[model samples]
Target: MDGGGDPQVAGPVIAALMERAAGETRVAMSPETAKKLIGLGATVRVESGAGVTASIPDSEYEAAGAVVGDLASTVAGADWIFGVAAPDVALLSGAKPGAKVAAVFDPFRDRARTDAYAAAGYEALAMELMPRITRAQSMDVLSSQSNLAGYKAVLAAANTYGRAFPMMMTAAGTVQAARCFVMGVGVAGLQAIATARRLGAQVSATDVRSATKEQIKSLGAKPIFVEKVAGIEGEGSGGYATEMSDEYKAAQAELVSSHIAKQDIVITTALIPGRPAPRLISDAQIATMKPGSVIYDLAVAAGGNVEGSEPDVIVEKHGVKIIGFSNTPAHLAADASALFARNLFNFVSAFWDKEKGEIVLDEEIGTAIRLTQDGKVVHERLLG
Candidate 1:
């Protein structure tokens, strides 16, 4: 997720513009969102062909009360710039001085790009960094997008595997159900467990938090990492896992390596914010997996947790297959775009004054999302 929203507005707001992000298949504003924004008293303009990759036709936007135009024409007088990722900084710099830009712009991993948006005079709202508070749940983009990613990761792994997920009965004998192991228990991991179980696979999961054990068990799957991380339980904040001690990591590696050998499908979803993904599977362990086993590394884009998992590349090592595809959610673009677009709508609606047709962003939620304003960095973590 990207952007910093300049939530303060007193006068009439211009159109809530959705420009086509080059090479991005996910559109920030879907037809569903256009209708919602229209009801909020904001004229919505979606760039022509913006949602085509998501298989949404232009007629859909028109039907939702949004005008379709070329990027420049749509962006003119843009008060709110909503996007899936960061838009071209130069393109947004041409907007009005107080214009606001909101998107899933990763402010922490790539601070320079975010800073460029600030220098160009747009407030950025990194939707992923929205605090995990009760009120902001509807606007939580990371969970929405990641939930899709986890579901897709399993489907991808299952499709790649030559065998079936569920047990089969035959005149010969009863075939055993595929064994699936999921690493990490965030929104993505939980979805992975549910998806695999729905496919009738024997699912087992691991997480650094003890809290995940019940969730894992409730899904009728076994919980891993319960014994190994005892002393380091609750080592994170905001429901995210923090860095473990070197010794604890070593123990985890030993435990996870042994577990990897037996799994028919392995999905690694471990990611520490602003850091390389924690390495859970090593090359030596990969070598030990059965020749036909498939490992799907969701963390591959963040420097994979599984060794030899290349970004967007598939490789087989000693008979085992390693898959590392970037943007798994984008692979399921239609729903990903819909969910993401809704998140953007909810984020804007949270601050929009329906009566005044203006944005009021001074709430505490603003403090977590607004990265820069008035040509200055506003988020405390970004400043440090």
Candidate 2:
């Protein structure tokens, strides 16, 4: 909120606060989005130094017509609070009653936070719950962030591996291309395949959803699938892959065991919403991989898809290096922040009512993402 308390100011106050989570480098609002929000007749405030980790300075926000101030001044009387992760409930104490907070609440994993928000009379919008529909494509933060995380996963694995991704032919001898395998061809997996292929690796990918086979081939990668298996069509609601049957899991494990043994680099991106990541590689499977091989688990933060993968640690097994980051997109913070801010801006502007000078979310998106309203946990998924 503007410090002057200017009565001339119109529309709701939108504020972007600093992220409190450890290793969170991305900011929810960027200068680009701040400018767009201001154009929509809203007052935009950003906490000074909030974007420092993402390499965005306070001067940039000021130049974009956003008022920059400390945390207390930024949130004071604000109507809407924006954040990458949901800000601590304590931080929202200064906001107006029933203020709208739009961010990644991770409601299933952290119900206590949503409960606090409900008790505080704040409207909690969990961006991760944004429905997967054609109209909401531009507002999909998961896809935006996961795409970058997938590209980073492959690059990190390539860096850790002793061998080069591309083959070399010199006066000495011709070197073969490194073999890369991507598990779970979601947005992240597809990006992993594309990135690995760009790095000159012989890329192959697999997914429970057979529909992704063509997507893999389009990226010039081979598709390794457990064909003719029941439950192989595992695409779930919101385009996420669901848990497969025991029979399908066995077949997948068998196929992956043989394929992974030959892979020089493996990147796993499988994840089920509100559930632990499905295990893809076992300790025995890791041992089968060649010495000096590298594996990057993109789902380590969600309990991991590869055995022995630890967040932000390089675990070596049988001379194979397994690595992953709890917050993969934060490694490329600048771009990640830009895309994320745009996604939030897209969601808000799509529902902005010009005459009313406020955002009025329609039932489709509102019901899908709203976790709390009217001082209660209103989301059906979270209600007991």
Whole-model lDDT per candidate: 0.82, 0.92
After best superposition, candidate 1 residue 139: deviation in angstroms? 0.5
lDDT of 1 at 373: 87
Best by the lDDT measure: 2
Lowest lDDT block of 10, candidate 1: 1-10
Provide the global lDDT of candidate 2 against the true structure.
0.92
Q: List the residue pairs that clash in candidate 2.
A: none
Which TM-score value belongs to model 2? 0.98
Model 1: per-residue lDDT, tens digit, 138-212?
A: 989899999999999999999999999999999999989999999998999999999999999999998888778
Residue-level lDDT of model 2, residues 1-384, one tens digit each, is 332355766878999999999999999999999999999989999999999999999999999999999988899888899999999989877887888999999988899999999999999999988899999999999999999999999889988989888999989999899999999899999999999989999999999888788899999999998976865453566798887888999998999998999989999999998898999999999999999999999999999999889999999999899999999999999999999999999999999998888889999899999999999999998886
Backbone N/Cα/C clashes per model: 13, 0
Model 2 error, position 260 (Å)? 0.9
lDDT of 1 at 98: 63
